[model samples]
Target: MCSDFEPLGKSSLFTILDACKASTRKSLQGINYFAAEAGEAFDGIRKMIEDKVALHNDSARLIENLKRARFYLKSDYKVHVARSSNIADHCCVYALSDPEKRDFAQDCDHEHNESCAECSNLTRTLNEIERLLEETEEDEELLHRTLKKFRSYREAIEAWKAHLLRSINQDLCRENLLDKLSNDEIYLNLDWAMKFLPIKSREPQSEFFGKRGI
Candidate 1:
């Protein structure tokens, strides 16, 4: 995600890139060991759910539970992104503490579990659907539907990450260009504007007023 800072010069670009690197590093590696563990703990639950769905494709109740779990898991990821700056705030303490024991996925092994943490805090689920065989999924259409949704979700996440990185790269390119500029040379950044209209002396009022159309 682009931060509030804008790069106006090489020095500014350096600072912006440094901050972006730090933010990405922290987000991926986590602020502390516990935070990273929370993410891994969530992945374990997701994998466990996938295993259950594979083993018991005929269980409709289990499928429904998986559906509900999907909703909770996706919502948890969104909340985590929104609250990335403050993980402990606006999140369930239980989910934050010893997240390995939060087996919401296993809870769905039999039936839909209605109870969740007060804030419904869970970890961000990653893409690990490679183990699923197409033939097995074909046997259960509902299972395929659930997995498709997860696949789409993961694709969207990857796309966003790509876009953020692309934007950072563009800024870095601009910085490089500026760095090569000679002392006498100047850089002009042109931004999009409304259509240009040629001004004429004593133009008609109607023509002058309607000359520009965006």
Candidate 2:
């Protein structure tokens, strides 16, 4: 099975999480008897801790906003048919987000036979979903299962967004770029690109995803 962690492109939440863990661990390990008095000696460690907190808070806030927006990939979507109703509705795949928001599935088959690898993989995924439905004893259980899977999907989306935002922010960080924006608030907002970026900048960032679809 493919691993869920770090599945998206570079500089995603996994890096932030790893940095936070390492910083916390190093802080504990580097504790010194003179730390209370050794101000400069503790400065680097203190900055690391503060950086971790800022990164974590930024990532977490963006994730929460995305969950509220029902933002997710097309592949992460699914349709569940009820026993009483023949029609199935597609659902948004982000964890704890509204399930009613959905996109129709895109087809990829043409001349593939049943034995084809892609076809087989698709069949297995569908079968597993069916199995999960069969095992679900209550309506609440079904929703719980979907939310759990969607949480993973959300992380993947966040990772891709982070990667795209970093590319955009690289240019935005130049001193002249802030002058072009003409506002300190907008300049500061670029620090957390996805969450606080202005609409004019956000257009290109979103278009990045529109073209790549990842």
Candidate 3:
């Protein structure tokens, strides 16, 4: 009833990205309401308002990107890792072995010299994919850390707002910049994990235990 070679999953990347765009646009509307009333008189207040708006926008954007990437890492990139690892990697392993005795699947044409385009392409593709995945791993870690900081800073921001509201001058238009966040109480340590990674087999290592040994 179904085809043998089906796509791994539906392409929901565009749908997720569209939702991100819509939400980001809606959030920016908050900044428009607080535009400086008297131009130069309340520049500091305006700057603070814009900064708060920017933080919200930037945080939302980073979270959306992470979300989208996480989806791809689970779906599309997972498929890519599965497919790219099959024939080419087997051929590569064969090639690295004895040139004369080595054998690969007949269709796996890694027998060509390094100058061959097909050979070069397959070689570079795996390397580049691993490199890119490593970088993505680092980036995702940083994004997670930023999210934690935003959570911790929420309390500081709320306290700052409450204190400022009680001041004789509640208008922000006249301020230059809000004070830097000093409260670093909330700390989060995230366990790092790679959402997109090669599905390497443990069989090779497991075979060692099967051998006759003490």
Candidate 4:
């Protein structure tokens, strides 16, 4: 959950980060239109929206690549297993044709078909791919859980930002007490800093900060 977990490399890990950033930025930009003043704040929000759109598009491409990788791995697994089964079946047929020759044929066929170095290597490859797939799946689950927590954090941030902006706008228009306006910006900045800083930390601490912000 390290903000350093910022999307990197060609892996699905990057995809998750891109998606999270995209969602967070888009939400912030949407909220900003209703929450912030014109000029700097509005321009900043517009830039965020543009950046988030790009990230979102990149995430989509990454997801498609992941799907293709998964499909290839699955197809390879199926083909390897099918080939193994067919070879085993052929060995069984040869062994059954002659009772006297059964032992030799079984031993020879098992070594030739099932225990060949090439077959062993292919089996190892399949096992490794399966393990990688499982790890990728687990990573994806963790990413989703992290994203859910992030969404909640974002919602709270938006609400707090909007409330502060409204208070400031009201004060500027002479609708709120000046004394109240005096503390609003300070308290809002404090709240935002508290929420933003710790999210940049590593997991567990990051999650703790996110929940606390909520």
Candidate 5:
């Protein structure tokens, strides 16, 4: 008895093609936006655009592979639904024969398997495109935050440097007082006077005494 399995439908092939077109369009749109906004965060946006472009290229290649597969199925496998209904009628009969072959044949039905595979590919590609787009947006936000932090740090360092300069000048006043003291006066209270003078905290190496500039 001829199997009663249905051949792949034209609708299934068209659906895959449509999905490919949609995926390509979405990726292209994302890439274009990323490129246009490159100046916003040049490195981040450029990387995102490159990722999207790569994904688009991959999807295009997959579509070409599917097209080749379809051609082979139609020409070699005699699986064209429109040209010969025998493929479908045979599948239907086979489905009623041995239970294992019935299940296997059903699983291999081109319409079902091909459509499922195409849909899966489309979903995966769409998700990747969206993720890359989001990364660009997040990177821009990070750059803005970093700039604000840098400006705040710069202002704080300037203020700290000014305070340090004033403290160094105060040491000069102490030096003048020491010069004025007679030998007897200096000897009379040398330990007490030494305690009052501001001593340098180690030798000045860099700004903030070799500590963090901020």
Candidate 6:
């Protein structure tokens, strides 16, 4: 599988694997992370593969092989994906500005600021859906499922955007409070870690099936 991907650059490999994962309703949180040019280079390849699979007598075998490839390759591929997604040299205007009002820029030289948006998951997911929609143009069931998954992600992002706006509003309120504070009186702020780990133990047999993480 690695040899098959060797001829394609890292970005094309990234797109193929991500597109497969997207079809499975996986979150495209880390993709094209180390790719020099993470453009849609392998789109034609995907279409060709889909066509061959359609015309092949053993279509199930081809699809099964693809499923296995995705499962096995992802663990190895994630290192590059994580690196590429996490490291954005530019001030990710994506992260610094309002999510709703953010503009996609070609060249941004501003100093990098930490932002969840810099991960570029949402952007990639949006693009993947467009491709998925095109690829599944003839398959109504697949199209419906793809749209369903997209709507779920869209709802989640919308909620996060609303939360971010409220946080900005709170920050403005805090600034006004700070302006009114006296020299003797100080405003105290408390920070807490809100991160959690997903832990599972002694799970039932039914838990092993359907929409599970690899």
- Among the numbered candidates, top TM-score falls to 1
* lDDT scores of the candidates, listed in order: 0.43, 0.34, 0.34, 0.38, 0.38, 0.43
Candidate 6 accuracy as TM-score: 0.30
What digit string (tens of lDDT, one per residue) describes model 6 on residues 1-214? Answer: 6666648789999999988775443222222221111212123223434564433454444344434433322332222222122334222233345545435433344433443432354345345445645564687886676557545544544343333443444665688899999999999998853332223422222343343343
Across 170-201, the per-residue lDDT of candidate 3 in tens digits comes to 22222322343248544344654323222222
lDDT, model 2, position 83? 16
TM-score for model 2? 0.19
> What's each prediction's TM-score?
0.31, 0.19, 0.18, 0.19, 0.21, 0.30
Q: Sort by lDDT, best first: what order?
A: 1, 6, 5, 4, 2, 3
- Quote the lDDT for 108 in model 1: 15
Candidate 1 lDDT by residue in tens digits, 148-195: 755554454344333333344466568889999999999899985445
Clashes of each: 0, 0, 7, 0, 12, 3
**Model 2 CA deviation exceeding 4 Å by range:** 1-138, 174-214
Model 4 agreement with the true structure over 1-214: per-residue lDDT tens digits: 7766765567787888778775432223222332323223223322333344333544444334434433433244223322113344223333234557654433333343444333344334334433433444446775465345434433443343334433444444453344566643643322242323333212322234335434
Better of 1 and 6 by TM-score: 1
Q: Cα lDDT for residue 12, model 4?
A: 83
Better of 3 and 6 by lDDT: 6
CA RMSD (A), model 1: 22.3
Quickly count the clashes in candidate 2: 0
lDDT of model 5, residue 206: 27
In candidate 3, how many Å is residue 106 off?
Answer: 19
Please list the Cα RMSD from the true structure of every candidate, rounded to 1 decimal place.
Answer: 22.3, 23.3, 29.9, 29.9, 38.8, 18.0
